[model samples]
Target: MNTPPHFGTDTPRDLVGIGIGPCNLSLAALAHPLAELDAVFYEQRPRFDWHPGLLIDGARIQVPFLADLVTLADPTSPWTFLNYLRTHHRLYPFYFAERFHMQRAEYDTYCRWVADQLPGLHFRHQVDAVRWNPEHDVFEVDHTQLDTHGEAEALGRTHTRNVVLGIGTEPYIPDALRPLVDAPGVPVVHAADYLTHRDTLLTAGHITVVGSGQSGAEVFLDLLRHRPTGHEQLHWIGRTDAFAPMEYSKLGLEHFTPDYTRYFHALPENTRDRLTTAQWQLHKGIDATTLAAIHDELYHRTLGGGWPDTVLTPGVRVRTAGRIATTKIELHLEHIQQNTRTRLTTDAVVLATGHRERSLDRILVGLDPYIRRDNSERPRVDEHFRLVLDPSVTATGCNIYLQNAERHTHGVGAPDLGLAAWRAATILNTLTGKETYPLPTRTAFTTFGLERPQPRVPAARQAAPTLTPLVDRR
Candidate 1:
């Protein structure tokens, strides 16, 4: 980096963001007009791209268009998605299209466009580590400059009063299928890279998809459309008991509201953990449109009479897997309900097993002693999104905020695009000790608990309990 003359250890920036994913990008865009707050964001990628490999044709984002980077928090901001359309001279086309939900590719392009104009966003600069200097009471962020090809060229550091971690998540490869996915020339892959390996997968004789989420459904539908009708040898299996549509009902979606998030955070830790596991369908379920497309494709093939030579099974677990020669994969699966075992062979496997949060332990290693953790040993994030740091660390007034890494503390909406701006605004409000974006006291019609501790929390939001307590202390 050129290290613009004004930015140095002696001159600390107000904030420094680690990764330029959509989360941090939103923060940067919102912070752009705030001349008082000096902030800079670093990214390893050469440019912004949201799930580039999963930008399959006809795939649409689950959230509405207004859930874009800046709109939800600051609709009038010039960086809104509407402005992206206007800038590209496609506003009329977009208006006529009436697409409430944006296409995945278009969303990626919109983010790229926004990233291009946002100043102080350093692309090709990989943030290596962050350490707090007690003497200076500022964070020292070390990063390496990368060339266009992503090769490291030089090292540099920046000093900041605060740091935001938005490194995002990583594609998860299941343990049973790890060997094949790691081996050279093996076709087993994760759905995150579906587009990158589309041609090879399309040519494969028998393909098996190992997830039932939205990505899995989209990949299966895409493959079905291109393959010959009757010869479509595909197997789609998942651990879910049944293929389920996302909970998109008006009231059901209240779970993603700020009110619900706060309520969820105050619950007992064990209860929160159980709810996360049981509420998989809330965020992990397939979108209704994608589910319909898959069914419509299958129904179209049925017009010719026999099944489309595809096996769609649920409630099955992949017990183990092995390879039969180099070109074939053998999956040992156990039917969870029936307690029966079976073996299936395939030419290629797409493990849309979903993603796991990228660890902050690597970069935050220097501050480990001062960082507090939850019962699970994961870093604890308070209601304000700041890490629950020890007094020693908090004494410096150098806060560490998190993005998309607080699902355990925040709920399913932690990673949802709709809540991105709200979270950014919340973090900014708390960071600056000012309401940059004043938020509603409550947002959801449904109150999560029977007990309302605050008078400001409306009574209409809470429902009257009709059943007696299961465990009677009386």
Candidate 2:
């Protein structure tokens, strides 16, 4: 099999993607068809694996199978989920199953299948830094290749006209639980490592799950099912007012469309910040189906006798956590609405806290002087997802792009799987300075703001797409 040639060549590439997560994989897949464009992606890990720890049995992705790495951008591309099924000779079975959402494990396998076949993805290669090279009119990217054990085996450099940072989010641990997690006595673990610690957790006498998001619900449900019926001894508590269901109504789903993203970006900085928090239900709440499954399980356990020994409470926050002697743990909790406080003792704790977008400071510190920032000191990102760099860097015809790091600007859809392909296609079009993949003029049924949005054109009435001449605005 022919692979992309190693770096250190005389000619520079069009773009160098920093991380080979699903976001960058989508970009690479879309970029693959544009013959004039040259792109490569590097990942620190050995191969592609999405949320391996939270891939609980029987769980499925939130979106439909069509929300694959390439389908939303170019359904005709050979990398679509349907094509994967056909190639694997599972098309008939999948069709008969009639499942809209694909299983989590199956989706991981599909991604690995794509990652294995894509030529330019260099796994086990860690990107170290990025800097602007005015002399060469390109961006300098330094990377280190790692062996199986993740030790640096060799160092290399690549020059590219543009760089795309797809290094995704990291598991976030709140301050209150830091010491407990860091300490060795208790089996405190994040949901990101739930599968690895499942056995240890099950053996405990009592367990407590924190956070009210989908992960928390799933973890609590899984534990509830495994524990004996009467003596479940499980406590599920979170900071939310209620175990609210995610906003899954068709119109509410439109917030994830490109139209809403445009409107959100156009808002004032403060408004965008407020909306990110106010619109939490769109992305952070538990799925209705998962909630139903949990309720059903709890109802089943109550059919025989009184009730399961589980304490499910919301509107509570963990004030702090400490070890009780050597075998147990103590948690200081406060109810947000009732203004009440209490303490709970548990044998183990599972933190289902969500992730936060990883900071790009270490990798981008080299070019800090040239990058523009917002009033809050956050790096400013434009509608095209390019970092607002100083004119000096821009005039040199070099650029840096971002994925999954623009939630402050692009709204909640920044980390969404459904928008991955669309964003990738948008980036490619911006890079090529042409409509390489003709995107729809509009995507949502609702107008985001009062301002007149582009008319929703029907497929039959849409005109022939026009190509705009490339301008060297850099």
Highest TM-score among the candidates is held by which one?
A: 2
Error of 1 at 378 (Å): 0.9
Off by over 4 Å in 2: 1-5, 452-474
Cα error, residue 241 of model 2, in Å, equals 0.3
Count backbone overlaps in model 1: 0
Residue-level lDDT tens digits of model 1 in 98-156: 88999999999999888888888888888889998888888899988898788988888
TM-scores, one per candidate: 0.93, 0.94
* Residue pairs in clash, model 2: none
lDDT of each residue in 183-220, candidate 2, tens digit only: 98879999999999999999999999999999999999
Worst 10 residues of 1 by lDDT: 1-10
Model 2: per-residue Cα lDDT at residue 378? 93
At residue 388, what lDDT does model 1 achieve? 88
Off by over 4 Å in 1: 1-8, 453-474
